[model samples]
Target: MAFNYRRIIVKIGSNVITQANGLPDLQRLEKLVDQIAAIKKSGTEVILVSSGAVASGRSLITVSDKNDSVATRQLLASIGQVKLINTYSHLFEQFSILCSQVLVTKEDFRDRLHYLNMKNCLEILLQHQVVPVINENDVVSVTELMFTDNDELAGLIASMLNAQALIILTNVNGIYNGDTKLPGSAIIKEVTAAGIDFSSFVSTGRSQFGRGGMITKSTIAQKTAKLGIAVHIANGTADNILLDVLAGNVTHTRFVPNKKASGKKKWIAHSENAATGAVQVNEGAKLVLTSTKASSLLPVGVVAILAEFKKGDIVKIIDERNKLIGLGLAEYSSDKAREWAGQKNQRPLVHYDYLYLQG
Candidate 1:
């Protein structure tokens, strides 16, 4: 494949930007900015999803007064987010690049309207030739996160903004096929199949100074690939890594996207965090929903109500076998839905306008 990416989302994790001292590493940050500047000079629109605010904040305060607690983390993030963005702004400005800081919470994309608005804001920034450096609003969002990680955010932004590629920069070389400690272990160069499982080779451990692991990056890569966007998971420390990956001269894990899925289908099927409830349907309904020219889900096909949800909530539409067929905003409450289950006639459970089948 040729490097024809026009718009790209680059995710820089905490470890990639922060040193072991829990502070922003200038050398690494400078190299990264230089690469991104080079990419911008090539006429590519770039969005950065960064994750070093809290880690940088950790070292800002005294080590003797450390709690390593969530509350303290929130406080540190409040302090460090400013510093992190300021540093990014200065570096980008040196290269004549305009940068803007945007703090987002997972709540921003909880609904269709909200998500579209967020999309519009990003579109405006890109149109005006400003690079938006986004980070999760860690201080404000406590109960629910706006993104699972920067990896997930990058995937969402790549898909949401109709980006051509997503490059996730992490500490590792890429997804390894065997024990990362062993000598013979190798990186999986490419993943092309839909629903290709990589859990067996993944570890549950998270990275230091970062919330997500390699497995999390891999999962995000797979989900974004379904939307016809290429995903690259590569080592951030490697020299000219970004340029090399674009040139296809580097050893990195690449996810080749399927070109069949539409934009709406991608927004639904890959919305792992935005969904709210579950609605189980029988065999007849499952077949119809997955078939070509799918009609609205009628009341007669619903087999069970697995969760209590209100109308307009994005619920998971599952088959009797517990296979997820699609996601749709509910038109009825859980009580009304259960009462109308298997009935001959009723309003469409989920209208065609909102229903999105799995890719």
Candidate 2:
């Protein structure tokens, strides 16, 4: 099939690879891997964000009350990660394709420097034709230190890599407008910035082995699409679903790309959840930050500082009314910002290269 997107991010959810027995579904996994290989042979570059380690580990290790705890969950992820990646490596070998395992934590993307470094690493892999099979480092992840789910991770990667589209493979065919079992219910094929409110049909409940659900998927889809990348949520079990969707022969929920964003804006927008503090700017400051076209948030514009953050941390830029207007890396500590607030002769709070305004 002639797919439109040359570079794609494909997310394989835990439910897609987990069986009713709480173990990895080898047959299903093998089939999905085959489809990925087929797509790659068709001249498409693919990055796989896979989740199933914790589910697979449960079958190998006995579970108890303690197993439900965060520490135990991390142990399970560590144990199954090896087996999961090995299985993927073996399958891809049959197609003569090489793949590498990449494990990461939310901390890696929290810093702009590390974020760019990661992009460099992935770009090098793609240049050499090696597929990057990535998974969250659940071994050390807990609470806010974790991603909402792999869908959120995939969206971040899609935007970071400047991929044309992201394909989220889940158990469901797509997002439906009503009860899926009902005769009239159907998949909503497309959504955009001006789309209807589909949240009414979304269920907050997550999958048995995953942390996110339809709501999270839809939300991430819209967010990534707004940064000028398309997103598709489709059933992984369907025959050649990946190929079909790319060929425009499938019925999947598609989030069409909005106006394109500069590479820097995409980074800032996706970094919303990573904010470490806030800088309260006055009317003059807000205008200076947003209208300068390319200028730093001068210390003279700061009216207040909220929360404690060290230099080089991501901070939200708010107005005097406490409305969030932008985000950027603070060059000064919160204490420094407090000391320099309303002072015209002080250094800039945040440089222009690191600032991103909200729409």
Report per-prediction Cα RMSD to one decimal.
2.3, 2.8
lDDT of 2: 0.87
Least accurate 10 contiguous residues by lDDT in model 2: 59-68
Over the stretch 225-301, how does candidate 1's per-residue lDDT look in tens digits? 87789999999978888999998889989998877455565566556567878889999888787787858898899
Per-residue lDDT of candidate 2, residues 1-359 (tens digit): 34588899999999999997789998998998998999999889999999998876776787678446887888889888988988899999999999999898888888779899999999999999989999999999898889999998999899999999999999999999987878898899989778656678776778888899898999889889988899999998787888888988988899989887778777877787889898888898777677837778998888778888899888999897888898888887999899888998788888777777775
Candidate topping lDDT: 2
Clashes of each: 2, 0
The TM-score measured for candidate 2 stands at: 0.89
Instruction: Itemize residue pairs with steric clashes in candidate 2.
Output: none
Cα shift from native, residue 178, model 2 (Å): 3.2
Candidate 2 deviant stretches above 4 angstroms: 1-3, 65-68, 181-183, 282-301, 320-323, 331-336, 339-353
